[model samples]
Target chain A: MRRVVITGAGTINALGRDVATTLEAMREGRCGISDLKMRDLERLAIRIGGQVHDYVPEDRWNRQQIALYDRFTQFALIAAEEAIQQSGLSFTGKLAARSGVVLGTAGGGLSTSDENYRTVYEEGKNRVHPFIVPKLMNNAAASHVSMEHNLKGPTFTVATACASSNHAMGQAFHMIRSGMSDVMLTGGSEAMLCFGGLKAWEGLRVMSKDACRPFSLNRNGMVQGEGAAMFVFEDYDHAKARGAEILAEVIGFAMTSDAADIVMPSKQGAARAIQGAMTDAQLNSDDVGYINAHGTGTAANDKTECAAVADVFGHHADDLMISSTKSMHGHLIGGTGAVELLACIMALRDGVIAPTIGYEEPDPECALDVVPNEARDAKVDVVLSNAFAFGGLNAVLALRKFA
Target chain B: MTVRDKVIAIIAEQAVLEPSDVTGDSSLEDLGIDSMGLVESIFAIEEAFDISVPFNANDPSESDFDISSVDAIVAAVEKLKAEQA
Candidate 1:
């Protein structure tokens, strides 16, 4: 099996438009959740979300291209551009055909769906817009990324709710490790901050009235956010031979499904995933130094995840530093795992652990050292990023500093 | 004030349009109200009148009811408010 490492990473989140700014905000424990300011939404009970403010499409894409792409796909393209540029891997020769793209998203083209539904029903129009189907499909982001970058290898989109990005990245790692591809761009993007998406989330009854407070006794619920995060993965020898700067090595990955409930999480499910990754990497529980938790700030998720960590690591959970970047960026749903994976890679590289920003009062149920409310400097070697989604999907990625 | 005048004012405010721009027969599309704008309008009406709207803003097809015009929205709002009472 070939060793796979991340050569580049890029992100656009509520904190900032790029990876550096986003990472700085996370280190500082900044909370991005604020009152939503759409033209409407004057009367909704929950009015706050992690909305991407002042993002002008004109800055990233032309008017014609913007009209063809949904907000989610646009984010994917912009992030991919940054990752590809940073990777310094030229797709000019045979490498072009061997490269692939995989993306994850929960609400692809939801804004487009809302727009066309209104046009057809309220306007008495017989036909929908020509770009409606292309824009609204779940695979739109992957398809757009492949087309934009001319990647010809495996291309698809994973749809595991919040775990979508972790699953996507895990699959990419497997593909490269198996020599199926030399280069792959894998990540997740989401743009569900529109009024219609907000209304649907309102029905779920898990939206926070205030900002998301992960692992806090007064935590309400998760805050919705929008963004994209991508990583360029390549075989170790290929990256080294090309003089590419390796970001971090993907040591192990595991995915499992609870299969017991749709929304409720299971500690057993999460424990199995962590164990599986450890077995794959041939590492003990004590090998991991930091954990990027799914930590959605919902009462059930935080407790369940904490229990899972305790079960898998035993007493080691107290010594290991664990945190949720979601406290700063809000929950990016499908994009959360991908963005959080970057945090893991950076923590392993920079020897710094980002904090769970909104934690105040500690919950006895979640007694692990969460690196609460402030960044901590630590020499991290192995880092794990955990993501659990609706329908019991759980995915975990283990990363290590490049040797 | 009549219910009609109040409904028009609510629609204008919710849709972010001038009061004079909305007419009883003017379709919401013509008045530039999208689905999100319409859902917000419904929410505003429910809050203003202290009632619950029966229509599911999430599932428009299930409702089978249209609020495309000022008169139609007013009728829907009034019907929901009366039923709540």
Candidate 2:
């Protein structure tokens, strides 16, 4: 099998607008959850979310681009611009035909759907916009990314709720390793902070009204976040041949389904995915030094994730550092795993373990060594990022420091 | 419509049966109603009575509304309607 390496990374999330700013925010343990600024706030019982209040689309795109690009697709383009620029590889000729773009998002164009629905239903309109179908499709982001970057091979999208990005990136890695593509633009984006989006989630009753406190005794629930993270996954030889800078090596990836519950997380299922990733990477428990947890700040996820990690690592679990960036950046849902992958890169590249902020008191159920409230400096060669979504889908990725 | 009659009518519609064929003791599973049917039944009931049901699909045991049997669901709905009154 061929080796896959991440050549460049870019992100615009609740934490920061770029990879550097995001890593710095993690280093400082900054909390991004605040008062949501979306429409119809009074109707929502959950008032707070991890919204990107600083994002102004007009600053980046003009009237024409804005009309064609939905908010989610806009995020994908912005992140892709930084990632493609950082990679320093111009896609043309053979490279253009072989490269691909795969993105993940549960709500592709929720803002568009929400706006049009209100116009037709509430306003009692007889007609709708002409570009509604293209803007609201699940593959819209991926399609636009491919067109923008001249990538013409194997473009698609994934929509597995919270696990979407991990699954997307995992498929990208497999594609490069199997010689289907030499380079791929892979990550995720989400823009579900509209009134309709929040209202639907409100019915689920799994959201925190005030804050996100992952792995804490006083934790209420997960907080919704919106943004995107894009990365360039290239074949190891292709990157090295061009003298492209290597960020981290994608060594292993595994996905598993519980097939048990629709909403509730399964510990055994999560454990299998964790173990599978480690096994696929040919690394033992001792080699891994850090874990970016799936911790959604809900009562069920934190406890279940901690149990799964403990079960997978055994005695090594206590020594390895685990933290949830969600407590700082909030849960991005479909786009979450892509953003959390930034944490693993930070650990493997900078030896910095991002802290799980908002931790007040430790619960007995989650007794692992969670770096809480403060970032820690340590030597980390291997790291794992976990994403367990709703509907019992779990995906885990293992990364190793490039030698 | 009475709670029992309305509830049975929704369930029977999902099951493709006459309302008279459905009994208060009939379990949702026995009536061949799946989760999708259950959600549709709940929506139909909500629209029919304009009453919200406090059902937790994740943990039905903890929810105030009962979906164990048709009779239990009727009792729960009547209680919610009374509380609203």
Candidate 3:
């Protein structure tokens, strides 16, 4: 099989609007979770999230594009523009036919549905927007990205909840490695911060009203976040031929399902995915110096993920540095893994490990070098990104620094 | 029904047992109520009493609303009602 490498990366999350600013924020260990700004905020039990502020949609898109795009779709298109621009490869002729886009989004156009539902039920209106269906579709972002970039190959969207991005990116990697595609714009986006979304999540009662402190004994629960992150996955040979700037190499990917619980995570299932990824990459436990944990700040997820890491790495678990960027960016739901993968690439390329901020007290159950509160400088060659979603879906990706 | 009786009724319904079979000292687990059941019971109690119980399913023990026993839940609900009043 041929190898795959990341040629370009772009993101517009709570941390910052692009890759450079996002990595800079990660280096400083900033907290992006704060009081959410939305309509009817007083009705929510949990009002804080990693919301992107100071954004103007009119500044980026025209009237017609705005009509066709939802909030999540807009985020994806913006990030995709930056990614495709950075790659410096314009899809044309044969390249256009061989390239495509695959994105992950659990709540595509959720805000649109929420608003229309309110219009019909609460306001007793018979009419809604004409483009509501197209705007709110789950694959709207992928379709738009493909159309914008002239990609005519295998384009689709994956919706595995929190693990959606990892699964989508994993598919992209496989497609490139197997020569099904030469270049794929792959990532994820989510904008589920609407009133209906928050109300539905509040019923589950796993949300924290204050802060998301992952791996900390005083942790309450996860805080929701909204945004997107996109990447360009290209064939190694094709990229090297064009003299592309490679960010990192996608070495391995593994996905597993617990088939046990719907909400609660399983240690055995998560451990198997991590182990499977390492085996696929042909790397030893000692070679992996960093891990981006799927630490949701909930009591169950943090401890469960720690146990899985310990089970897979054994004694070397103590030497590995693991941190939850969710502590800063909050849980992005389907789009979370894509944003967290940026931290992995940053670790492998820049040697700066992102910190798990808001770490007040270390939990005995999650005893490891969490890199608490402060970013650390660690030279790491290989890293892993873990995404364990609800419904027992687990996806792990292993990456190596391209030499 | 009194606050205690209402609390007992809710817990009993979640456990799928008659209200008479439930007692104030009975724990949720002892009554065969799991985590999801506990969450439903909390919702029922909140709807019946019209009071928001400061409970988080992630860490029930860390919550201010005591869910240790039926008696504890009733006491916490009564206190919340009085404070809200």
Candidate 4:
């Protein structure tokens, strides 16, 4: 089996518009969440989010392209351009035929749907935009990425709620490892901070109005975020042959279903995924130095994730530095794992562990070293990014420092 | 129907029990009402009474709206109605 390595990484999140700015924010423990400025903000109980400010589409795209692209698709395209450019590989001939795009998005073109629903139902309009269906489809981002890059291989989108990005990235990794593809463009994007989206989430009552205080005793719930992060996963041999800059090696990936509850997370299921990833990578528990936790700040998720870590790592769980960047960037739902993976890369590559900001009082249930409120510099050989969705789907990816 | 009766009716529907089987002192747990059920019940109460309840499903105990028992939920709904009025 061929080994996989990430040659390029790019992102546009609440913390920053590109990879460098985002890592800098993570290093500084800066909080990007603020009072959300969107249409019909008064109707939402959860008023704050990690919204990307001043993201005007006209500045980036032409009118015809804007007509075809939704906000999520636009974010994906922007990130993909940065990632593909950084990879320094043009998709043509055999490369173009073997390369693919796999993206994850839970609420694709939700803003478009929300507006059109208001137009027809609320305003009693008889017609809608002609490109509504194409723009709102879940695979729109993946399709657009493939088309722009001229990738003709296996291309699709994965939607497993919050675990979407991890699942999509994991599949991309396998596709390369199994010799189905030599390179894959993989990541996720979400732009769900609209009136209808927030309204639906508000019904569940799992959103924090003030802040996302992950693993804190005073933590209320998760805060929604919006953005995209994309990466180029290439075969190690392929990257080495081209002398491409290696970001990190995709060593292992594992996904599991709780089959227990739709909303509540299961510790055993999460533990299994963690253990499975380590086992797949042939890495011992002691080898992992940092973990990007799926800490949504909800009362259910943090405790359950901590318990799973404890169960999987045992005594090493105490020594392992785990942090949730979600507290800084907020929860992007489907797009979250892709953004959080940047923290893991930072840990393995730069030896900087992203801090879980907004951490106030520590919860007894989550007593592990969360690297709270301050970034830590430590040489780490391996790291894991964990994503557990609302549907009891858990995906974990293991990465190793490139030698 | 009275506020208590309406609250009991909503709880019964969530628990899939008869209104006659529900009592003021009965806890939601005793009636097999899960977290999702509680959220639906809260929404039903909000729509029925036309008052917003300050509740967070992540930590029900931390929420200002009491949900300890049928009587507590009814009392909390009454307080919200009075405050909103």
Residue-level lDDT of model 2, residues A129-192, one tens digit each, is 7898998998999999999889999999999999999999999999999999999999999989
lDDT of each residue in A114-188, candidate 4, tens digit only: 989999999999999899999999999999999999999999999999999999999999999999999999999
Error of 1 at A12 (Å): 0.8
Q: Quick one: best TM-score, which candidate? A: 4
The C-alpha TM-scores of every prediction are 0.83, 0.86, 0.98, 0.99
Interface RMSDs of the predictions, in order, are: 8.9, 4.3, 0.7, 0.5
**What's the C-alpha lDDT at position A360 in model 4?**
89
**Which is superior by DockQ, 2 or 4?**
4
Error of 2 at B52 (Å): 8.5
* Candidate 1 docking quality: incorrect, acceptable, medium or high: incorrect
What DockQ results do all the predictions give, each relative to the true complex?
0.03, 0.12, 0.87, 0.96
Candidate 2: misplaced stretches above 4 Å? Answer: B1-85
Residue-level lDDT of model 1, residues A35-106, one tens digit each, is: 888746875767887778888999867878877899898888878888888998767567878899888888
Candidate 2 docking classification: incorrect
Q: For model 4, how does the per-residue alpha-carbon lDDT over B1-85 read when each residue is reduced to its tens digit? A: 9899999999999999999999999899999999999999999999999999999988899889989999999899899889998
For residues A23-54, what per-residue lDDT tens digits would candidate 3 score against the true structure?
99999999889899999999888899999988
* Clashes by residue pair, model 1: none
